[model samples]
Target: MVWRSILLLSMINLLLLFSSPPLRAEAASTSTVRPEFARKGALTCMKCHDDAAITQILLTPHAVKGDADTPFGQHDCESCHGASPEHVHSRPPEGALRDPPTVRFSGPHPSSLAERNAVCLGCHENGQAIHWTGSKHANNEVACTACHTVHIQKDPVLVRDRQATVCFSCHTEQRAQSFKPSHHPVREGKVICSDCHNPHGTGQDMMLVKDRINDTCYKCHAEKRGPFLFEHAPVREDCTLCHNPHGSTKPALLTLGVPWLCQECHDGGTHAGNPYNASKIFGNTLVAPAPQAMARGCLNCHLQIHGSNNPSAPFFTR
Candidate 1:
């Protein structure tokens, strides 16, 4: 019996020696726990939230190891939210533990412009938003939350392809354009709203960071912005004069395209009925390929269709 007792005592000492260093490291890590902020509050957060879940929160991304570091993890409720002071008090105001005022993500709707936009501008000062103050949205009283939601993890804007929904909400005209038979593939989610429009502000018209609407389009179509051997004056002037910037009922966003389109100005009755009878765009009983070989209609040969340095007819033809 004496030998057994001695062995048990030795085992206990060995266990303590092994565990002490880890415990001490843990206590040191939490040493920064503010005395005023750390309370064995009466209402433990887990008391209602359930032990497994609160434990999960600490494990989640929103959980921060230290204050003033990277963003608190999503489920890391205590990081940006602060330590639950009254949590142990057991009688935290019914919603006392509710979202703090610093949490600008929520809404009963901010009473003022600064209050509403403040939530987002605090973080998103870079990127497309550097000059948002006098931009159209700011002037129109459109709040950041009016189009976006920071805390809303499940919304469409947070997703890549669906971000356009936020823009379409205000651009009802785009919505109307898509209803037509020959519009862009917006309804199918191919072209996003940001593709053409800069939601943020710029000194340019309609908040376009590009000086002109055609300049804005030239980015995607570099080939079209060139000073071609042959120029199409009307095309260079403003593509919108003959084209619909948004979707169109004419396949390629063209206002009218082909025979009827060219005839508007090219009406010498096809050079007074030349050999091929060019006046009848539908020659040989068919509109085989209207004017320009019919690939995307007029956009085919008039590749520099937007404008050309050639200066000939500048009628967007070869």
Candidate 2:
């Protein structure tokens, strides 16, 4: 009886194995396999992307092999592009596109904005970029690639001479203002957009480099930042109240020339209420031409117009 039972059990086991061949194959195929890195790193990517623009990244700071913080020091191209095993090894179907890298900075079918930024923020979340999270550029969906070109050896935004052109691409109004008659020395490369404004964002308004607009002006115009006995109310309040820092048609970047600019505030003062015009200067009139109507206007007497340390200079005049 025992021998008969053993033979029956062996026959049942063979039948089960034969009937479930598809299940056995499926189990083997579904087993989890880890994704792989390209064997030759950037060299493998260079096989297809061997253009000058792509290859020039080797000369950039990002390619420093000695710095473990850099891309080359870590996973080479995979450090920024991500481990793209399928992109490296998979074959595409007929007339279909091949797989793309995990993170793409640009190109038609590029990855999402958040995905691309996350990859950059992975390595650049500190320093000047720390305030980038809610910055105007980030809020407006401005990508880092919009201003920066990592593949290039020298990024235009980082070059003082070429920086304004990059900034002008978006700041069209400022660009027009920059070309005005009385303007900052931006075109001459003596001054740059970054000199006063921090594109990375700041706690100040208009992303000024300093806490206040006046403080930004004080960087170059230190003489104006005085603890004077008599201070001009407008000068203390805000520099933009009388001057346009970007550019202006008036001399000295003033919104309006001397007496006119001063009259905006001093309208009720003695002789200040009088309008000085061509009619007042040349036309036959009973009233004589006021001294304030001369070529230098209010500036003639108010030599210390900005402020005064003199004991008796009540009108900001020394």
Candidate 3:
């Protein structure tokens, strides 16, 4: 009876070994398991990151090593910076200071752009970073650290009021445009760059937050995106046809002054091409003067230039 029981136990162990292939394959398909360098060094994070400047990363979400799903949760700083056995060794240098455990994102001797981006993409490949590999910023060799400061508790680019300042560092022309009198309230902190643009790679042209230019503009200017009885072809085609989203010298963010803007498409249609004269614009006569330059020039007559829902407003004059 004892021999029979031992035989049954041997058969069960063999059966379990045969079924283990499927379990091993499932584990292989998930994130690759990395060596635990923190354990090998017999050290804690604070051992090396003792300074306030570098230790501040502990205050952020990246330092939560208990999660097990994230890089930090897996192996602390070594998860992103890489497992550096050499960096942990206390060997005296011969000529120069020893190399870093991993190539850092930003510094006098920073890692290559591809290397820096690859580290960020390890966990951030979902969401907005999905198309980052082929995006304009990637093509231009812009590193993730160029705009993001991960070590700090608060990154300036993440703040709405301070976000534009970071963008203006690279977008000098936009900085000048936003300073114009008739501009979006970017400087005042009311309007922000992220409202229109997605800095993290988007499928749209110019990294727009929305798929289409008009659709992006319609988020704020929904009244302008009308299915009116009289639809202007240019307005339907694109908002950029008449308006500059950045600042302009003209009111309403127009690319040009009213009469001149209207003339871009209207040409010499009726009195559209007629330039404003001093007699009509300045001094008043007995008869009412042509309001070519008075109240928004051509817009004084064609009030519904965007579009008109009214059936009688054929020329968008209503």
Candidate 4:
């Protein structure tokens, strides 16, 4: 019993010396953290948040880093946000976008959102996000912090699916459309809006990443881009001519196939009634003479059908 008591006393003393809460309090009290321990900041933030998350946010590759090694973080957030001189005493208001009233951080008050943006833009203005000022997202009061959590590591912006979900929250109509039987499978993790648009902002009305709408579609449907020897005027001009790409009851996502699909923009010559001698697409086009052969439809001769590059091919024929 005496030996056990002695061992227990020694263990308690070791725990008190090595794991003392006072040691941590003393370490955090200094204005400038020691250089060796400078890689991490927001010491108070890590009490609830995981250390791995805090470390990852600090290590992000943005031009302006929040890492302790960086001058901004090394000097503490107060360097830019201003010192929270009075925060230690009085509590700040709720949902504060800016630093608490107690803190001397720069105020978004009495200034336009543009002015608040200019503060951070001083260093980060050269990147792809520079055009975000004129973007629809900016106009909607969707500030930089909505989709981004600087305090949270693994920033949500990097997750493509999550980013799309953020857009869906606002564009619920598109979300409903995606749930339909025929869609680009956006909800299935197959497609995302950012694949075609620049979410930060764009000059295009729809925020397309490219100057032309076709340019955006070509990213995934490169086959549609062709300089064929015999080009279909509508096909060359726009992809939406025969198809409702979003969702369609027609096969291959076509708006309508056979006579209907071709007839919308295509008019028949002076035939008495249905003037064409041959059949229409997909079906027999007419009667291919043999009922059995009608099952194969217009695909018979127009095999190299989409657009043929052959010099001798007439009417884009095989």
Task: Give the TM-score of each candidate.
Answer: 0.59, 0.82, 0.81, 0.62
lDDT of 3 by residue, 1-318 (tens): 675446444533443454355336546754454433644221244465555566556557775544666655555677777777666664756876655677576557777777778888888889668878778888888788889888777888888788889989999999999988789998777888989988877978999989999999999999988989999899999998888888988788889887878888875535566544434434554234457657777787788998988888898889
The digit string of per-residue lDDT tens for model 4 on 16-117 reads 453344347646776564432322233332333334433344334431333444433333333333334343334546854433422221335433455445
- Clashing residue pairs for model 2: none
Tens-place lDDT per residue, model 2, 1-318, is 575446434533433443254335445665552236665567667778756667667768987666779887666788888899889886999998779888888877888889888888888879778888888888899888788889988988999889999989998999999989999989767899999988878866788899999999999999999878999887888999989999999998999987888888887535665644333433655344666778788887788888999999888678
List the candidates ranked by TM-score, beginning with the highest.
2, 3, 4, 1
Residue 79 lDDT in model 1?
33
Clashing pairs in 4: 81-105, 279-285, 279-286, 280-285
Model 3, runs deviating above 4 Å: 1-36, 40-45, 94-96, 275-289
RMSD of each: 10.9, 16.7, 12.3, 9.5
Question: Which candidate has the top score in lDDT?
Answer: 2
TM-score of 2: 0.82
Highest-TM-score candidate:
2
| RMSD to native, candidate 3 | 12.3
Clashes of each: 18, 0, 0, 4
Error of 2 at 108 (Å): 0.7
lDDT of each: 0.55, 0.78, 0.73, 0.54
Candidate 1 residue-wise lDDT, 28-48, digit = tens: 777654543323211134345
